[model samples]
Target: MPVGLRDRIAAELTAVIHGGDLKLERYAGPPGDPGLFGIAPGDPVWRVHGQATGMLTGGFAALMLQSLHPLAMAGVDDHSDFRADPVGRLNGTVRFITTTTFGSSAAAREVIDLVRLIHTRVHGTTPDGRPYRADDPDLLTWVHTAEVRSFLAGHQSYAPRALRLTPAECDAYYRQVAPVAEALGAREVPRSSREVERYLARMRPGLRVTPAASDALLFLRRFGRTRQERLVVRPLMNASVGLLPDWARAELGIHRPAAVRSCWDLPVATAVGRTLEWGLGPSRIQAAARGRLAGARQG
Candidate 1:
């Protein structure tokens, strides 16, 4: 693509990802602010989240996985703005993740505290008379597990060879990322690869294919602000679908052939990821945080 078009695409994507929630300046001029993780050069969270394609794909898969739990889906179905303003909801989610991941220590905690506050109001009874609360420790753990696991899968599959994490790094990511969920009052949040797998397996019996889940999936497949943006989102969703576990695919009625998923979906998503990486270059927010850390070290 030409430089102008590339820049335009980059701008649009940046707007979509940032949602006007994080200012470029928040990351700058903060000497010695190591942010929440105090991540190093090769921190697993930084590397995994740096891949926009993987994050987008994994995020959608997380939604799908979360929708499997009727209680979780019920909370979103009743209280969330997903149907009326899907993009806006997406923008908010992007804001929270980016802020918590790349913002300064104060900024990161601010978003987390805001989310915890919001969760206090997100309580209701499900259609089947079951009660659900966003702050419920078990529910929080389920959401956290589904989300980060999906993200790791996306990065492991789509990120460049040099950036793709090894098994050890994958384990490291799980161990390191549990604190955010813990802070939100999640109990027994999984902290390793084996633990996560076992947790998901243990929770499978409680999952279902409710009408709300189906509607949510349909809306996700079709959501975008414009025709152009929608076009770009299609392959990303396909790649996300490809990332789902076999039982999840069956539950969601996803019928794509395995070979097509491996051959077509992965390649298309990889190409899109490369385009994003080239267009976006380094994430501005992360750069600012890194500068702050370097400034601290130098000081």
Candidate 2:
């Protein structure tokens, strides 16, 4: 069966969250102490980095399936923007926090809830002490759209699947996802077949860069190259990482120290260095991606 709009959007958003400009900001910071690799104490940057890493791993698919809690928190209210653009809003909140914190579905959900809570605390009250509905559609739509587009732009190079849909198919799928889109308040979900094809064509290159692969690239960029100029090179590295077989993880020391050094130059050159020395794990790619995207928007 042909990939539907939801699937394509999911894939594209995944790519953006991984290797896009958002990833660059979170992982492109200056290298930290090598000795602290795995054993390093928690730092704001590291926490965010870890979260980005998790997103690229298995958690991304789970998030897409709506099996994640943050999505559920948005509820199914049509009047709420969260319903229209659950993915987008979720992505925005995720992008703002530390990626390392999102190693599991539970962790990711906690971070997301926290973000919403914080935002509400900051902006959802009037001077008269009346609490505005935290579930406003306009706010939700803006937040989700910004985050989603940022993720897509960041991972533009990794998109692989073409948005090739027959006019009929495009119309049908659009209708399916339309409720969600409407809740998100997106202008429209590609009304015509021509528009659908064009959107798909634009998004194809990014689909190839899976979330996990994008996280790997960010990992390499942070620990390996260390040069600002090489930041743009991570998407390519991510593409390669996505293609690696699961069997290669052990042999390649994907979770080990020596791999870090071989992959990139930094204070810590080994996976052991990152884990034992700094307490950083290869998980949390997704959170980190979200953080980076949020940071970019802020910057």
**Candidate 2 Cα RMSD after full superposition onto the native fold (Å):** 20.7
What is candidate 1's lDDT per residue for 78-189, written digit by digit as tens? 9999788776788888777766666677877887898999999999998889888999999999999999999998988888788898888899999878987888889898
**Compared to the true structure, candidate 1 yields what TM-score?**
0.96
Model 2: residues with Cα > 4 Å off, grouped in runs:
1-103, 124-136, 153-157, 160-299
Q: Number of the top candidate by lDDT?
A: 1
Q: After superposition, how far is residue 187 of candidate 2 from its true place, in Å?
A: 14
Candidate 1 lDDT for residue 5: 80
Reference-based lDDT, each prediction:
0.85, 0.34
